[model samples]
Target: MSFPCSDQSIRPRKMQSASLPGVMEAVRCWCGDVCKVKEVTDFSDWLGMKFFMCANYESDPPESISTYVRPPSPPPLCMYYRWIDTEMPDWAVTEIRERGRRAWASLDLEERREKAEAEEKAEQKK
Candidate 1:
């Protein structure tokens, strides 16, 4: 299931290109690298919109690094991209906002539950 944009407690993930439709073709970036389509989950009016971004584009990583099995991918070669879809409708924006709110609320509850359980376990150990 897709999570909300506001709830960043979980890591963001990339949807496989195989599931993408209508964007079939060899779309290349200005840097001559193949571009990948990523969906907008920022919980804004643009939510669910797809865009073609450079495959080499690496967004800013989190400040803390939990583990590093291997070196991360290279940085963005060229900041070139194009939006696949146009402006979203009012109804679509409203729907996306509501969905995002619900998603974050559910995730918040789950996180609180997990934290409480962990605290209880620690108390028991003590």
Candidate 2:
């Protein structure tokens, strides 16, 4: 019943900031340089973070920082990191290793025994 034309020039209003999802920020060591990265939460949960081992480090293990400098205006170091939307502000190399250890520990003697027994039974069935 209203007029056919509304203010066509004006754009629709956006939601208030109160409805925005949380933001994520962290420092990551990629290639050789450390940089900051940003992401948005509420989209997905972060599983874990992992650092990449630079391929160059194998053959040209830099004697010093200068030795690892980017070449001829080369792009920043090629380091890569796996980041997820989660709280891992204190994650370090050692922390990651500890996770691996704990995961292995979770499969202790009892679990191993059960697995072995199951395998033996399956073999008998065959």
Candidate 3:
């Protein structure tokens, strides 16, 4: 409907809610560790659904929020299929790289274990 906060001066008609059934869902950002699921009523421009984003961005909004544009009613921004597509922090990126390296090391250890198992099997056959 016509939200008082929306730029109603331009469009006199109340904007219809998009067709998608929107819902509250957990969202995580690159800069923060907490993943919070807020209600649509919590936002002003929320038509129905929208993508998750850092609300603290430079753009000043009438309402205080921590995410980007909320979606209209019809096409709900299905958060279940969404991901934390953000610019990762340098430390977090490094941490992920380290974890990947550790994973590779674990794989190498498994290879060695397999080789030892093969050697033992051959010895038993001899």
Q: Give lDDT tens digits, candidate 2, residues 1-34.
A: 1121123222112111111123533333444443
How many pairs of residues collide in each model? 0, 3, 11
Candidates 2 and 3 compared: the better one by TM-score is 3
Which portions of model 2 miss their true places by more than 4 Å? 1-90, 113-126
Residue-level lDDT of model 1, residues 54-99, one tens digit each, is 6776654555754485466765567655666567646668887788
- Model 1 gets an lDDT of 0.62
TM-score of each: 0.47, 0.22, 0.35
Higher-ranked by TM-score: 1 or 2:
1
lDDT of 2 at 61: 28
Winning candidate number (lDDT): 1
Ranking by lDDT: 1, 3, 2
Candidate 3 lDDT by residue in tens digits, 47-67: 223233233322223455534
Displacement of the residue 71 alpha carbon in candidate 3, Å:
19
Cα RMSD of predicted structure 3 = 18.0
Instruction: Give the range of the ten consecutive residues with the poorest summed lDDT in model 2.
Output: 11-20
